[model samples]
Target: MSDVKDRVLDAAVDLFARQGYDATSVAQVISRAGVTKGGFYHHYASKEALLYEVYGDLIARQLTALEQILARRLRPADTLRAVIGDLVGSTAASAQRALVFWRELHRLGHERTEEYRRSRRRYHDAVQQLIADGQATGEFTAVASPEVVTFTIFGVINELPLWYRPDGRKQPAELATELADLVLAALEG
Candidate 1:
């Protein structure tokens, strides 16, 4: 993305998170981005188009993190914990965008939803592979199916934004380690 387009997308993400999709306006985005109406229109045909770009960027970032986790060679249990740690650790840096994506992007329709689903499936597949590895290696016990294991981890980590304020109570690394331990305990047979 060009600098101007990047600005527009960033502004849109913030506005969508704060005021919601319906409540935000193109004019507001333009103002936030310090771009003219013409510049905004040059980059995005409509507000929905801008939102789609934002969603695409977010999904790409997540897939990249998952790939990093998968590339690590370690014990299955260690790998699972490491992957969860990677997730939580990366999420801390982009928590704002992730939170916005989680909270609002579902308002998108079937086609966009399907695109997001595809990206998410790749992410889940990586995790599933790790779980299967764990089961195969016998280092980690598998009481539940890999799909179930994936879903459980998703359920917990995806909810982090609901209660994850950056107060002095817990640092990102601390929270991630705690979450990794909890997930490990649950997955272990």
Candidate 2:
């Protein structure tokens, strides 16, 4: 992305997360980004487009990470650990964007919303499949259904932005490690 486009996105995410999608205007985004209206239009077709980009970009990056992790072909437990670590770390790193995106997701148009849902479902399905595979192979105990376990892990990740603090004692890596440990322990039982 061009410097101008990056600025617009950063500004959009910050403003949208703070004021909200409905309350924010293109003019405010342009002003905060320090770019001209023309520059903003050059990158995004509309304010709605910007909103989509904010969350879209985050999910895109996450999807890329997921693919890379899967490519390693690690054992199921290791893969699950990597997935949890990546999810928690990324969510903590982009808490504001995550918070705003989750809160205002319904504001997106039907098509864009479906697109987001599909992306999320891919991630969800991958984790669930990993759990199912482990259980089937007897590598992991079937203490809980894969669906429930997947939801349990994701539930904590989704709520992380609410209490996660950048300035807090634990770094994202540390938190990820601890979270992965807990989930792995439950799965192993």
Candidate 3:
């Protein structure tokens, strides 16, 4: 992305997190970004589009991270642990955008909303599949259905932004490990 575009996105996420999508204006984003109207328009069609990209980009990067971790071919337990850590760390680092996203995601048009959901589903499905595969291999005991397990995992992650503090004494990595350990314990015995 161009420097101008990056600035616009950063500004949009900041403003959206602070004021909200319904309240933040295109003019505010333009002013905060320090970009010309033409420049802003060159990258995003509207405030809605920018909002979509804010969440879309975060999910996209997360999905990509999932793929990379899967490719490492670790045992199911280790893979799940790494994935949990990555998701937690990434969300904590970008909690502003994550918060803005979950709050404002419904504002996107049907098509873009569906696009985001599909991408999100891909990530969700991958995690569920890992659990199922582990069960099949006898690595993970069948303590819960993959659907429920996946739900529990994502439930904590999705709600993380509301309470997680990046500057807090407990960092993302430690929290990630704690979460992973709890999940792993349930699956193992």
Candidate 4:
């Protein structure tokens, strides 16, 4: 992406997080990005197109991180712990953009919504495969189907951005470790 496109995405994410999809306008995004309307149009066909670019970037980062962690061949339980720990830190560092991604995906209509779902499924499949690997090796006991377990774990991990506040009192890794324990206890035993 060009610097102009990156600026537009950054500004779009901040505006969407603060003002919401319905409330934000293409003009506002352009102005905030400091790009002319022609430049914005050159990069994106419309507001929806711009949204997809921003969302795709977020989904790519998440999927890449998961792939890197699972590729390490760690124990299933340990891999999950590290994955969730990374998730907590990533969510803390990018809370506004994460929230915007979630909110806009939900706010989008059927066609664009389906695209988001596919991107989501790719990430979910990676985690489910890790769980299946663990189960096959007897590293993890399956109390629930891999799908169910993956979804539940993702639900817990992904919701952190909605409620997490960065205070000097607690660190993201510390909170992630606690969350990891809960996830392991629920799925492993």
Candidate 5:
């Protein structure tokens, strides 16, 4: 994205998180972005498109990170830790956008919603598969089903925006390490 487009998206996420999607307008986004209507229109077709892009861009970056992590061919425990770290770090960095996206996800149209679901499912499936493989190889204990383990790990990550604060003592990497330790311990037993 161009600087203008990034500005527009950032403004949209901030406004949408604060004022909400239906309450926000294209004019407000453009104004907050410090761009003209023509500039906004040059990038986004409508406010809805900007809303989708807010979450879409985040997920796209995450998927790329997931691919890179997988390519490293780390041990199952190491890979899981890396994945958790990536998720927590990225999500904490963009908590506002994540909050807005999750709260207003239902407002997205069917096609865009499906696309979002597919991206999320891809991440979910990869984690679940990793757990299953670990169990099969005796690298991780089958204390819980892979499905349950996957959901549990993601449940914490997905809800982080609700309680995580950048100003807090715990940084993203610290939290990621703690969370990964907890999950890895469970998997070990």
Candidate 6:
């Protein structure tokens, strides 16, 4: 993304977080972004486009990361830890965008919502499959179903935005490692 587009997206996230999607206007986004209507339009079709991109961009990046991790062909448990760390770190890095997008997700049109959900499901399936593979190979315990394990991991990550603070004692990477340890222990023990 160019500098202008980055500003527009960031401003939108901040505004949407503070005022909500319904309450925010295109003009306010332009103003907050310090860009002209033409400039904003050059990057985004409308306020709705920005809204979608807030979470859209984040998830897209995550899906790309998932691909790279898969391409490395690591063991299932190693892959799971990498996936966990990637999600935790990325969500924390874009905390405001993640929070705002999820809060305003219901506002998206049915088509866009489905698209987003598809991408999310892809990620979910990968993680669940990783756990299932590990269990099948006797690398991970079968104490819990893959669905349960996958949801358990995502549940913590999805809630991070509610409580994460930049000034917190633990950095995102540290948090990621700790989370990976816990999940791996449950699976590997």
Per-residue lDDT tens digits for candidate 6, residues 1-189, read: 899999999889888988889999999999999999999999888777788899899999999999999899999988988998999999999999999988999898888889999999999998888888899999999989999999999999999999999899999999999999998898888
lDDT winner among the candidates? 5
| lDDT rank order | 5, 3, 6, 2, 4, 1
Weakest 10 consecutive residues, lDDT, candidate 5? 46-55
Cα lDDT tens digits, model 3, 1-189, are 799999999999999888888999999999999999999999999888999888777888899899999999999999999999999999998888889888997798998989988998998899999999999999999999999999999999999999998788899989999999999999999
Q: Give the range where candidate 1 is weakest over 10 consecutive residues by summed lDDT.
A: 88-97
Give the TM-score of each candidate: 0.86, 0.96, 0.96, 0.85, 0.97, 0.97
Q: Write the per-residue lDDT of candidate 1 for residues 67-172, one digit (tens) a residue.
A: 7766777677777777777777666666676777777776777887888889889889988988988888776677788999899888877877667777759887
> Higher lDDT: candidate 1 or 2?
2
Residue-level lDDT of model 5, residues 25-65, one tens digit each, is 89899899999999999988877788888889989999999
* Positional deviation of residue 37's Cα in model 3 after best superposition, in angstroms: 1.1
Across residues 1-189, which tens digit of lDDT does each residue of candidate 4 receive? 789988999999988888888899999999999999999999999888877777677677777898898789788898988888777787777777777777777666678778888988887887788788888887778787789888887887678678877875678988888888887886678
lDDT of each: 0.80, 0.90, 0.93, 0.82, 0.93, 0.92
Q: Is candidate 1 or candidate 3 better by TM-score?
A: 3
Ranking by TM-score: 5, 6, 3, 2, 1, 4
Write the number of the candidate with greater TM-score, choosing between 4 and 6: 6
lDDT of 1: 0.80
Give a tens-digit lDDT track for model 2, residues 35-153. 99899999999887888887788789888999999999999999999998999989998898888888888889988889989999999998999999999999899999999999999
Which prediction has the highest TM-score against the true structure?
A: 5
Q: Which portions of model 6 show Cα errors greater than 4 Å?
A: none
Q: Output the better candidate (5/6) by lDDT.
A: 5
